[model samples]
Target: MTTLAIALGALVLYLIAYNTYGKWLGQKVFRLNKDHIAPSIELEDGNDYVPTKKGIVFGHHFTSIAGTGPIVGPALAVMWGWLPALLWVLFGSVFIGAVHDFGALVVSMRNQGKTVGDIAGNVITPRVRVLFLLILLIALSLVLAIFGLVIAVVFRLFPQSITPCLLQIPLAIVIGFFVHRKGFNILIPSVLSLGIMYLSVVFGNLGFLADSNATLAAWPVMTWVTLLLAYSFVASVLPVWVLLQPRDYINSLQLISTLALVVVGLVVASLFGGAPIDGLRPPLEIVAPAIEQNVTAKQLPLIFPFLFVTIACGAVSGFHCLVSSGTSSKQLKCETDARFVGYGSMLTEGFLAVLVILACVAGLGLGLNKGDEFLTGTAAWNAQYSDWASSKGLAAKINAFVTGSSNFLQSIGISATFAKALMGVFVASFAATTLDSACRLQRYVVQELAGCFIDFKHRKLAEPLKTEKSFQARKTSWLTNKHVCTITACLIAWWMASLPAIPGASGIFGQPGSGGVILWPLFGATNQLLGGLAFLVILFWMRRKNMPIWFISLPTFFMLILPAWAMLYQIFVAAIGSDQSWIEQGRWLLVGIGSATIILEIWMIVEALISWKNLQKTAIQQD
Candidate 1:
């Protein structure tokens, strides 16, 4: 009953927020004019800038942003209890996440499809443009590395998922070719392709494929990570509609189906089953006492700052800003569509996050069924989450979601093995979509940054560089090459992912080659900080246009201060204040990177303030 309440309540709030606040921002604040020509129509090239229907663009945008962040972040944050996580995911998504995403998309669309970082130059200053790009590059590098490791880990832990996950590539290609080239109806073909993918899921679980073979099983996690990164390199370089757009469309379908299944299962288990729901999977209890009690009996940091950082994508993530401006803005057919594609899609992700919380909390309450033995929900959840600091705890956190999701499926009469397999495929597919998109975004960042070094005014240098005629020109143009940028981005991410997990610092979930976890502590701070910076950028743009500034300002200030405070605590107390050596503890690298990001953010904020004052003065003078 509690699960159903939370789920329905979140949905209602989101709908209200969308209709009221989201619409207000779109109509009054941003003034999204339907008559305005978007970049998609103006710059159509049968590639990235091709005009797309709102539905297709929404699918692409949703899947790209709805990665493992929503899943993993909420899964981890449930450690502090479901209530705190729930409130943040609900309120944060409605107010902060949707607004940030919508503003970024609309601003970019109005600015000729330029990225947020690129638009900073015009709105703030040229120097801030480079600074914003630097922040984006660092953030994207971590995203590429972390998501790649996450998908690889999913494949390793759930072998049955590999077949369906790998099948998405070819299926998407076929769909792309038929719809874009042969002009087939996208709906029928997409449904058929999804049906085929699900068939692979069943067969893969039944061991009818090579994925279950001993040879593939013997390969290390790093091997899978390497292959995934290589694949992302190719996916990143392809034109949007050819592979990226269609693939994300299919993934979005899978996500919707999964969410629907979980919701239905929760309702049936909670309302219809009566005693079974209570005895087997008990109602969700606030468990306020346990919030401070972990398996290891260590107290976590105060919920204020950490909760905001932890429940990142499920609530608000800075990365969504990049997605809004980087890709979605370019593909919008109508300026008005930004409200749906940008704002509505984020609310959808928030609902998914709500379901994730229910799955981890209420679903886990169903307990673990192993053969004839059973563990209560409390015991099972505690067993995996006893110690947040242990290296192995990361694996436990991920497995908790799988186990709980499978339990939910069982309530609907699905066999446990198939249930687990289904959930595994869902998670792996989500991560794979994010990994490829990050690679593509990173390539864009690299190219944009590389352009800064080129003397575009010197045609002798720039024009010949396009032909690779002179050695100097070739050197200058290499960074601008799509393939070069993609490969370089992949390799860097691969290196970060492949590094050895720090000894003794591995949380209970840590494993060798799980280097991405080392950087996890910094992810929330950096991500939210990026959100703050993005909001700041939006605020500056609004001020310049003489629009209402309060809507963007509050979130900007809230996001900036909380995450920065949390990061400072992490640096001074958790990393340096403790007796552990910074290098041995793996805090040095994170501290340095996090500090640099904070500095860049502060610099940009200062620049925006100065610009705001000048803009005010100029307006007064004109008046």
Candidate 2:
């Protein structure tokens, strides 16, 4: 009953927030007018900027932003205790995450769908623009590196998920062509795609397909990372309608369906418990303690800043800001869709996080069949999260969600093999959608960054250059090509994910590419810091418009202060100065990048402060 109450309460709370607080932000704060034209309409290029319907835009935006961030973050954070993670997710998503996403989307839409980084120049200062883009560049690079590794890990963990995920590509292309070229109704194709996707998941556990999946899963993580990055490059360079938009749209449909099923399964399990294993079914209850006890700082560390950082996407991830301002802002058909696409999608993700938390904490306690024995209650929860170290393993972290969620589905009479396949496919699909979206966003960031280095104009490049120095500058222009930028983002990420001698070896989810463990916390802090920086851009934008910003101001300060605290601690106290410092581990790469991120963040915040000071000074003079 406690588990049931938490699940139902989250759903109700999110809905109320959307109508009350979310509505207030839309109408009173940002003032989204339906009559206003969107950038997608103003600058329709048939490529990046197509005016998409609100529903399609919402689907794309939701899946792109949600990704595995919600799943993996909460799955790990629940070890700190479900109560803390739950509070941050519920409050942070409403007050901070949703608002940040909504504000960034609206600002970008109003700025001709420019990314938040690009808009920083007009709202704040040009120097801030470059600083913001550099942060975005580094952040997206982490995304590309980490998400590729995540999906590869997922594929390696659940091979049956592979074919179903793979099948979505051709299915998406077909839908893309018919809708864009043939002018067909979207309903038929959507149904057809959904049907095919589920069929793949259902049959994925049976007969020949299962064997084929095993063969595919056996491929090393590095090989899958390379191949996945290659796929991202292709998706990056293609027209949005051809791959990116359609894939996200349909992927959202299938994802939503699976989510609904999982919710139903959760409801059933909470009330009746799983179909009894060994003539016993434990009532669904959170087994992982209210606040973890007997845990050393070595096991879980201080939960203050780290918990906030750890539960990023579920609460307020910085990556969501990029997606909101980057891809989502562009596709919005009208100014009014900002609330639905931005705020609504984030709330949806928050709910997913809530589910993940329950799945890990409550769902695991219902029943876990381990070989010849069935474990329930505390034993079951411990199996999933005995200690932070075991739980942090790249494969262990994700498999926790998969295995736990499968238990929920299995509670509803779904077969064990099929439930595992479904959850596996669901997780992989999410990671894949985010991977593709990140690549596209990275290409945009790369292009914007590259444009800053134009020493030679295109008009004069072909003409005679008097000196060798003049010719050398022409090469920089070539780097701005869409293909080059896309490949550049993928290759760099590939290099990082391919780094050898990662900590874990053949663990529960096969030979681990332990980068996920190394990168997860680092990325969480970096990502949340980026979110805070984005809020700064939005705050500046609101101030310029003379819009009331009491709502935005607190979140801006919070997002900025907390992530910075975490990153500072991570660098000075943890990575550089701690007992198990990266220096000791010979991980100079992590140390170097982590240090650079902190430096960039401090620089940007200082710039914002100066701008604020000037704004106040000018106002005083006017008075």
Candidate 3:
């Protein structure tokens, strides 16, 4: 009953926010006029800028942003108890995440579909633009490395998921051909593709082609990582409608079905299966005994800063800004569609995060079946999340989500093996989508950076000759050659992932070896700081237009300070104070990255402030 209540309550609140606050921002704030020429029409070239229907664009946008961030963040944060995670995911999504996503999308659309990093030059300063691009490059490099390892880990741990995940690629390509090239109705084929993928899931669990003796079953984690990155290379370079859109569309259906399954299973478990509803409350209390006993005094950070950063995508994420400005902005057919594609998809992700909380809490309460061990909710959760200091904590959190969600599925009469397999497939698919999207976005960032440098060199050389067109043509040729940028981006990610794991950090997954776990500590702080910077960009844009700035201002301030505070604490108190050698090395690198990001953010904010004041004065003089 409590699970049902939270799920339904979140849905209701999101709907209200969408209709009221989201509507006002769209109509009054951004003034999204449909007549405004969108980039899809203005820049169409049968490739990235192809005009897409709102439904298709929404599917692409939602699945790309709704990746493992929502799943992993909430799954781990619930260790602090459900109440805090729940409130933040709810209010933060409505007030902060959606607003950031919507504002980034609308602003990018109005600026000829340029990325926020690119637009930073016009709004702030050109030097700030280079700095912003560097931040994106670093952040996305981490995203690619982490998501690649995440999917590989899922495949290695849950072999039953391997077949279905691999099979989706070809199926998506076929669907893309029929729907886009042959002009077939997308609905029927998309549903059919989803049905086929689920059938593969069942066969996958049956060891149909995934037998223990099969080639894939015996592959090392590195082998899997290599294959996944190779696939991402192809997926990232292909036309959007070919593989990216159709695959995400199919995955979105899988995501929705998984969410529905969890909701229904929760209702049945609470009402009919004798699960307790007392843990589902509004206030912060130590509901889980394992968290109380095992999660010691210093194991976790304070709820204020850590909670906000930890529960990133569910509440707010800087990565969402990249998706909004980088990809979705290029494909929007109508300016008005920003409200639905940008705002609506984020609310949907928030609901998914709510289900992740319920799956970890109420679903755990239903009793987890972990091989030979039959543990209650508290025991299962405690076993995994008890030690944040261990390398296994990441694997534990992921397992908790899988085991608890499987328990929910069991209440509906599904077999436990198949249930686990389904959850594994869902998670792996989400990670795969994010992995490819990050690679593609990284390609864009690299090209943008290349263009910036070329322009500077051209300015120097052409100062005497006044020959700008030659440099302009050279720049166009370089940027249009997408393969060079894409390859460079993929190789950097591969190198990062292939780096040997930190010595002495071994855990259940053994040596981390390119697994994102080594860099996971920096993810929250870096990601949230990116969000704050994105909000700062949006805030400055609105001020320049003389629109309401309060909506963007509040979130901007909160996101900036909290993440910066957390990063500083991590650098001074956590890393430098630690005695472990590997801890010092690995953590200090993250500190350096975080410190550079902070410096860049503060510099950009100051520039934006000065520009805002000067622009206001100019307006007054004109009047």
Candidate 4:
């Protein structure tokens, strides 16, 4: 009862703190405007800077920021016990995650929506801009590919998830038609879709459609990989109205509903049911441990670098930084919106991390009373937890906590049964949405890189390629054409994503690590590294704008430095082979990527320095 009270109280306090405290800081320190016009006119005509509502923008920002990284990182952290993970969530958000997110959005907005890359070039250095873009491209591409594998792994294990997952297709198409073709309002379709989506969940639970397909009865890993990729392609190319908007609307509902369940479940279970476990220590010991009997000495004291590295997305994420500058900044209906979208949304994700870890702890406790054989199989254990939760009648409590302060899902009469079933559908749906977003984002990166290199070569070759064929073969001529470049880039991405589709394969394809491992880490580092670099730019820009350094530059500086140090430290561990852990191998691969990024960023910073100096000298001479 005490624990449940504390948990509920903590949640309410955090929400209040984030909304009130965070908002106050944003408004007072930054004086962020909720009404700034997005500088879409300043950029090229792409989907990058489209104006959007706060709710829709929140959906995009939330989905992009919350990926496989958070889930996997925190899930594995459970071995360390819930307390450490919970503390990390609580502390890390206020100091690290929220600042990075908030600062990035504000800086990007002030910079005419030029994106992190352009800001680096203009404020920091020309070389840094290009370097950051390359790193971002490689990092985001790996993210897309790795997350595809993550979705695949989950689906292969849970056959019941398929029918409900596929329900988004027709629902999205219908919503798309109303919004685009029928000129219908977003509110109506969103409301209607949520209702129907709930029904699908109920219908599936009743065995109406869920038990339909024998072929889908048990999907192999490859089938999952294929289906996930296929879904990504369709989702990415479709109108936002049809798929992205409605799907995200329901997801928003689920996110709120699940959060609500967590709170309510904690209260009811702790007070009424007396939480299944108390005084349960983390499975692993810091000393000569029973934790990793099969594990080694170097891997024992999982301290310093490992702890920070393990909590990647929740603490800080480069991907969120990209979304901040790339898409979210441009869509700000007001500058003040950054606080809500940036800090608020990140805190929300941080809260979700806490809730999920709590669920894992609670679920693990219930499993312990059952036996070891049950816990050995991760898939079965997860299923058992769901069943145990349902059996105990505490699922609704957990869902209430997950649903958030809005209780929007509960308002719609979404029952506990449907809410539990809706979780898988929502996870699969969001993953699918992110997969497509990543693909499109990757294509953009490839095209940009091609253009940059092509322009460089074009200048060099112009004198030599005076002949007809030579002129046509110039870099600009070859690479500037969007259609050709886009097709080539998409193919490259598709090929990378398809590697996991091979027969009986279990190794990473491109970035590093085993079983599609390197992708997430690389993405994590690349995203944060970009965030760091963007922070540097923001710091410089804030200084130039005469804004107080404390709120903006200080946060920017920390976001840049902490993760930069974390990545560097991990690289060192990997380089020395200090702990022969699987993560260490992944660490080494990310280190290489990180090293490449630092080199690129340093060079870019230098170029910006030279450019800045030249401009100053020229002005002085003119004076």
Candidate 5:
């Protein structure tokens, strides 16, 4: 029952926070006015900036920000114990993550739906804008490269999940067509699509479909990465309603339903034990230690900075800010919808993280098998979580989540096969959403960068000459074209993913997604820094508008300081200060790139400080 209380308490707290804190931020703080024309309405680009309903916008925003970050981050962080992870997800999501996301959305929406990185120049400094966009380039490339492989790996791990996930594309396209082109009501198509989606899940593992899934799963990882990136390239270039929005919208529905099922399952398992293990039902309880009583060098250390970085998406992730500004901000038809699409989405993700914690620590306690012997309770939890180093890989982390979640579903009379397939599809589909969304976001970043380059080349040209009909001018213009920029994003990611993840291990053919794995070390800190940088933009924007800066300032510093602090620790304490540094491990690439990102972050911060000082002087002069 403690498990039930924890889950219920977290859910209730989110609702209260949404109505109280979230509402206040939208109304009193941000002053989201519905009458203020939105960028989607103002810009009215039928492709990227289509004005969208709040409901569809909410769906797209939630699923895109989610990805596997909440799942993977919380799953890994639990190595420190369930309690720390739970507290962070509960408080962090409400105060930090949701605020970060909400602020980014409103700021971007007010900035004519430009990405925060692009708006950084107007608010902070041009140099900071360039710095921030460079950071976005690296960060998004990491996501695009990593997520394609993540979905591919998910397909391999749970073959039955493949068909349902693949089927969502056409289903979404159909829904998009009827709703947008034909002027059909969205309600009917949505309900019908969801039913068809669940039916796919139901028969996903049966008959020839199962055989097809297995065959697809057996294909090489490189093949899937190639196809997935190609798909992302096309999705990125397409209009918003054609693929990205509708697909993500429908994906969100399935995810919400799965979450509903997990909650119901949790309630059932709380009252009575989960499905029988070897003809004996085992009571579902928190099996993992409240705190890891022992620590090893290879295991995670529960400390101020470590826990914060380890559990990013569940609590606060910089990546969320990009999603806020990049895609959702463009689609929002009204400024009033920012709170629901931004703050509410983070809270929902927080609840999902809570469920993941329960699934790992409690639901795993219900049952698991090892070779010929079946393990229940603590032993089952320990099997996967015995030593952090043992189950630290992507597959291991996902398996732990899937096994535990499937156990939860089983408690509610769900068949074991279907339950696992549902959870598997849930994870894979979410990752796929992130993949496509990142591709689109990356395209925006590239276009911005390209536009800057074009301006530089034409800086000295006369007004009329700037719009030259010459071949050179035409070639430069192509740089900003949506199709070209999207292709650039996908091609860069594909090229990077094709490289060996580990140096001197093999050529591109040896290991899949090697390039991203090599750069994986930088993702956590860099991503968090982005949130801080975004907060800085929001703070400056509010300051310039003469709005209250007190509220936005604290989170800005908190986000800015922590990620840098973590980077310093990893560099000075964990790496250089240690007996066996990264130098000893021969990871020169990590050392070099990580150090570069930190320098870039510091440079941007210094620029911000200068900008703030000038603002203060201007205020004094006005006074």
Candidate 6:
């Protein structure tokens, strides 16, 4: 199928899901009845429990979850052939990601706007909560560490993007102060922020900061790491009104604008740069027995892990579950709002992924085939195409578009400058927002842990010790609270990035992109696994409400089995020796992650069984 067809089909399917099935799921299953209030009603804090407008809340939520991850994942997914990448993104988003995210929010809202970790404990049992927390902490550390590397790579490649990003912070701070302190509303601050950030981009192009030692000098790797950690520190401590909220508000515009540009480019490329009927060739054609055998021997059903790995965003992202259960739930005023903001926003991101896939497909060339051949997977093909594409003009065209100086400018020469200026506005906004969101989640985990310890401390046959307010207050102290958690989070992330900077360190894990061969693919598999866990939890929740389980259970089971088999393949490959270093490392990494997930899943299963037994015992005793 052509790229255009994929894009149109994805859009149609998403709209249908959102309008019909999603709506039904919300009303009938999720029961977003207007009569129902968020359980937080008994204990609303205006800061976190303010009645939020769904549109504003969605905008806030989307910007927070949409990070550099989406861009990086799709960009790399081009490796597996655009078709594999496209299908994973399109299907996974709706079935797995949207369900996980939307369900996390719904579950948390049902339980007094508690964080995900807390809800798991209260609804399931303390043992389940503890296990879930460990999983989250480890997962989060991996996320921050890897993502720091992504940002560093971009900066290393495009030194020009530095000054613009740096300049954006103060501009965002000023705009944020303008809105909150100076009492301006969103519209004016947003315009001012965008205009200024766009200017910074133009300045970057002019080479103005290219040589400025004061602001633009290339620092050592350690310096960048330190700077990023410090930024995370401040971002986590700062109130959402000061930096996080305002910045995200503006970045939302930037994201929309970028998406629009991509759409426009794809349309222009497709209409003007149409490929032959066979524009896309099966990437598998040139594959050798060795590689295919390895993939098969790995026992990876080919479709299972591959599909899960490729579709990394909006749908079934474990990261978003943290956010949904973290601060978002606390702030939700109405239970029904989860369906619109959580489920709806993910559908939107899914559409964006489809659009990106379409862009790649449209840009692929059949003859002279610069883009298409570069996508195939033989070592010789990689080396040969790298030479051929360079010998041709492929490199230059790619450079131009990436640097944002291609014919893409002719359409919006002026607006382009304005957009560039707002680069800082977008970065600081989302970066700060995510920082705080991360902090809130960390704090929630800490509080839960503290409660466990305090309970253990008072286990004697004396009077039951009350530990609610005192322990919570200690956990929330500014010195010991969100700021500390944020700093800790960022520092750990920086440490991870620094490892990649070492000459042999990056390859120590595996070849650079091949991290996904293990990391991305396993991430996909575990993500689906998490979906299984989430589905079970939600299924149990539904049963509690006397609802039928078929609708949720069937898809959940299929998604679960498919990805598990895929992960098993990866584990098999890792366990067996492949001569290829890159694939070998990838196999091992997948096995490691799969093993950890299985252990965690087992713990979760046992906890759920115990909780069920206890409930049954209580019911019998009552009878």
Give the top-scoring candidate (lDDT): 5
Better of 3 and 4 by TM-score: 3
TM-score list, all predictions: 0.91, 0.93, 0.92, 0.76, 0.95, 0.77
Q: Top model by TM-score, which number?
A: 5
Number of colliding residue pairs in each model:
16, 0, 0, 40, 1, 13
* Candidate 6, run of 10 with poorest lDDT: 283-292
lDDT tens readout by residue for model 3, 170-225: 99899889988999988898779879988888887554475742556556556666
Candidate 5 per-residue C-alpha lDDT over 1-623 given as tens digits, one digit per residue, 9 for 90 to 100: 99999999999999999999999999988899999999999999799889999999999999999999999888878888899899999999999999999999999999999999989988888778889999899899989888777887789889999999999999888889888889898889889988989999998778999899999997876788889999998888889999999999999999999999999999999998899767766778899888886766435543578778778897999999889999999999989999999999999999999999999999888877667877888888778787766766788789888989999999999999899899999999999999999999999999888766665666564553223443355355888888889899989998888876755665332576546666776688888888898889889999999988787778889989988887777765564113444655677777787788889999999999999999999999999
Model 6 accuracy (lDDT, Cα): 0.56
What TM-score quantifies how close candidate 3 is to the native fold? 0.92
Colliding residue pairs in candidate 3: none
Residue 157 miss distance in model 2 (angstroms): 1.7
Mark the regions of model 1 whose C-alpha exceeds 4 Å error after superposition: 208-217, 274-296, 369-373, 390-392, 455-476, 503-513, 575-586
lDDT of each: 0.79, 0.83, 0.79, 0.57, 0.86, 0.56
Alpha-carbon shift of residue 472 in model 2 (angstroms): 19
What is the per-residue lDDT of model 6 for residues 117-218, given as tens digits with 9 covering 90 to 100? 666766677667777776666556555554444444445445555666666567667876776577676677677767776566666655446666234334
Instruction: Name the 10 consecutive residues with the lowest summed lDDT in model 1.
Output: 281-290
* lDDT per residue (tens digit) for residues 237-294 in model 4: 5544456555655566655655675566544444344222254322211111113232
Candidate 2 residue 28 C-alpha distance from true site, Å: 1.1
List all candidate RMSDs to the true structure. 4.1, 4.1, 3.9, 7.6, 2.8, 6.8
Cα RMSD, model 1:
4.1
